[model samples]
Target: MNTSPSVPGAGRRTDGSSVRIGALVPLTRPGWVEAGRHLLAGLELAVRDVNDAGGITGRPLELVVRDTAADPRRAAAAVDELAGLGVAALAGEYHSVVARAAAARADALGLPFLCSSAVLDALTEQPTGRVARLAPAQSHGWRIYADFLLGAGHRRIAVAAEPSVYWAAGARILRDHLAPRGGGVTELDMRSLDPGAVCDELADKRATALLLLVGHPEPAVSVVKAVRRDRRLAGIMIGAPAGQPEFAEWAALLGGDGTAVPFLRYLPERLGPLGARVGAALRERLAEAPSFVAYEGYDTVAVLAEVLRSHGPDRARIAGSWPQVAVEGTRGPIRFSRTPGIGVWQWAWPPVQVVDRDPAEPARFRVLHTG
Candidate 1:
């Protein structure tokens, strides 16, 4: 086996024919550990399948896993370490804060980084040829949310947002989209008030819907529970764009209340042939229902493999080739677009759905809208 002397975490195949790729994920964050686990499963499954199918250019693909714990500093260090390990490419990250730092480091090192799930709008703002996002940016997803609410005739909306870059980006997009139509958002700082008090205030405003932009699952669940308490607020629709699918724990936490609470999701019920194949592998191996994050992880690897197949594992060539890449990914056709204000080389269309947890089966959800 061939191993790097400078990087301790580097792995190599027993036969000594392998390409190392770095995986940066949070494994110990208080609220994000489960999300990290699911994403890791997807990446592992993809590597397995890729290797089985003859690997990247006949060289086995090995992942050098790093636990980021969602910290920016740690994430940046992980990138530097992965580069020192001689990884051909980098993939996998969930938190936007961590992704921002890792992306900068990867670019500085001249390595190709395919971000799996971070949605911060500013992530791709500065065009670094080294970075590309597998997931849609926050602004894109929020615009979808805004259109969904407006289509449903919700004019007077109230937004409960967490004080974080991730949440703030989405909130700003929603506000911009709604303002032009004479529909505006009443903003509430989730950190300042109790969940009950926030819901009560929204009820007083006679808000037609409540848009939650919280970063974690716990606060999102708390807000949903509080809104369900007021029978008078039954008419108000509750939607959370950022917390869904990853926050599967909410189903058990909210019980019956989890039903009919709208949240954004990327995975659809019907997985295509490629998605079905990976989904089956994930279920059998992980013994858990595959989430959208898993799909993202799988697709991230697939994209990197394509880059290697075409560019021969040279980081600069792989990074430079992103603009011309158009691969059929697990969700759909993956294509990157360069738009002003959005990140550089960002996926233009990532399949998304508005789903509500099934009332009878809290663990399951039903798709209410799709775009």
Candidate 2:
């Protein structure tokens, strides 16, 4: 069957020895490489575990990985290539916009895709059974974040957002959820302004909470620094619902400044038995405590393996099997169904938490609220 490939995202074996699962991840620049690394690690670990436990119907389960690099066109192209390469099904992607493009392409081609981590509510333009997602939808998780903002006694919210469909969708979710409760969202265009300007606007608007819908490292880091150092916005709470601060790079760059900024994470307060075992294994593999995205990666494979066992690798069979999937994922029981507003089959939700790094212990995450 499948021999575990030494290098992730490398070409798959063409000898017809393995049952292939096409993986799309951001492995290079502009792709949030750290997150991608964790995602790949979990996928690889699960693939190895699957093969060890007797690969699907006796064929080694192989992951034919492709780097989407946070680009939609690149992801679409990868889907086509993977489809042509004879992969049985598809999995993995971090960025919501890139995942949407990949999902659209896969659905059009009649390929089965179990998305690991992208949470945008509208994964496809129309309802389709070919694609399913494990992460909570953007509307579901982000509205919870908006509720957290309101709960923390912050009503006047300002969003420092970059120009992106994903960011725009997040802004809409926050706005729509908050407005009914006497809350409002003010959007600051990051296109024309710098970090100093962002701080100045937060002060002028008297907004108590500034949610960062911007990119990581550059402008987001800069804005956090400016606001943290500025006396005028001393009482302002910095937030990142997009979860830029989840990775080590954010902490390395900003350190304590990055701590205590709430972000959406898909996990419960405590890991169950399966989750605990998986987390320990992932921690050993990664040499660091795994992020929740890593668990999503593992759970993606867990569900797919069960599907492939029950329904063969045929695309139509796999596509039709989302409703039948019932696997014990790392986080919880994994299953899929049509959600109210979501276009594709969706995991009604995984555990959603608004968490922040403990300022007292920068290495530890503290759960602020659970939704």
Candidate 3:
């Protein structure tokens, strides 16, 4: 673990007082912990790198992290603690619901939050300069996926997954994106049907493709299994933005032909040394590859670090500096504009088929789609 010397006060605190920086990460649950570790690793590396290079304004950055467990209630409390500690800035995780809670807390406290990875579109909207996102919004991802499906000549699409608030929002965004193109949307609620019933319904659907908008791994996998039981649904290509490596295991268990996940293809891969380091460290620590959530965490930190460098450690400065920070993120450049969400920083991740599973690199599954 890299530690930085104390930060001084005011523009340039020659007094040699250190700034207390806080972060929120889910360290409790096994799944969230696994992802959190990768994010933490990335953040740690960035801190180390910055400190080694003589931190901002000759004052080193400090980090204090909390476990949010991806739970909203926990996340709210976590933010409250961080704010009370008087941190210079904050970042963490990929779940939007948690970010929403954290945003509310940050707003009440007048602190700048450099959202690490939560994509929920609402989290980005802070009446005050308290909350800002680092990645493409969740709604943006859904819209992009919907547009891609429409472009692929898939007008009729079936949606199936665990009933979650995120999925609902994603579905609405998908509908909006498809509406302009006259695409039809139908939902196959996994909660309402049994495994066998789901198979029959999906097999009978006239939809051209399947969109899995679920959150948890279990429900998403179950829906896929059901979709595959019937060979008649062979031609329908399946897609998921919240892809997991376990997805391959589920597909293999169900013997499904259609299984794919949408992910942003990072260019010059080494450009994100922080991300690469975090992923590598996580693999070594957990004995498994990091998940998408892990990548979200690393990306969030990278964006925050860039903003801090140019804008200084002030919360207001950080908020004001976003427009100036040109970040080449894991997905693409994240540039927020005057139109709230309408900006070039937005990304369109393409769907990729999970052709084969590699146990040696569980998190490094082979993607069918490439540049």
For model 3, what is the error of residue 4's alpha carbon versus the real structure, in angstroms, after optimal superposition? 14
TM-score of each: 0.92, 0.96, 0.76
Predicted candidate 3 versus true structure: per-residue lDDT over 1-371, tens digit per residue: 12223332223322244445677776666334545666676566556555665566566666777777778887787777777777767777657677778777777777777766666666644455556665556665556556567666888887775666777888888877887889977887877876677667666777777777665456666666666666777677667755443333443444433334443322223335544666676456545555545455556656776777787677777766765767765544666554455322233331222233433543345544333
The whole-model C-alpha lDDT of candidate 3 against the native structure comes to 0.60
Model 1 earns a TM-score of 0.92
Give lDDT: candidate 3, residue 262.
Answer: 44
CA lDDT scores, all candidates in order: 0.80, 0.90, 0.60
lDDT of 2 by residue, 1-371 (tens): 11225423323322246788999989888988899999988899888778777777777788988998899999999999999999899999999999999999999999999999999888899899899999999999998998899899999999999998899999999999999999999999999989999988999999999999998777899999999999999899999998888888999999999999999999989889989999999999999989988998999988898998899889999999999888888888988988899989899889999999999998999999999
- Cα TM-score of candidate 2: 0.96
For model 1, how does the per-residue alpha-carbon lDDT over 71-128 read when each residue is reduced to its tens digit? 8998898888889989888899999988998988888889889999988878844678
Worst 10 residues of 3 by lDDT: 1-10
Among all candidates shown, the one with the greatest TM-score: 2
Which residue pairs of candidate 2 clash?
1-60, 2-60
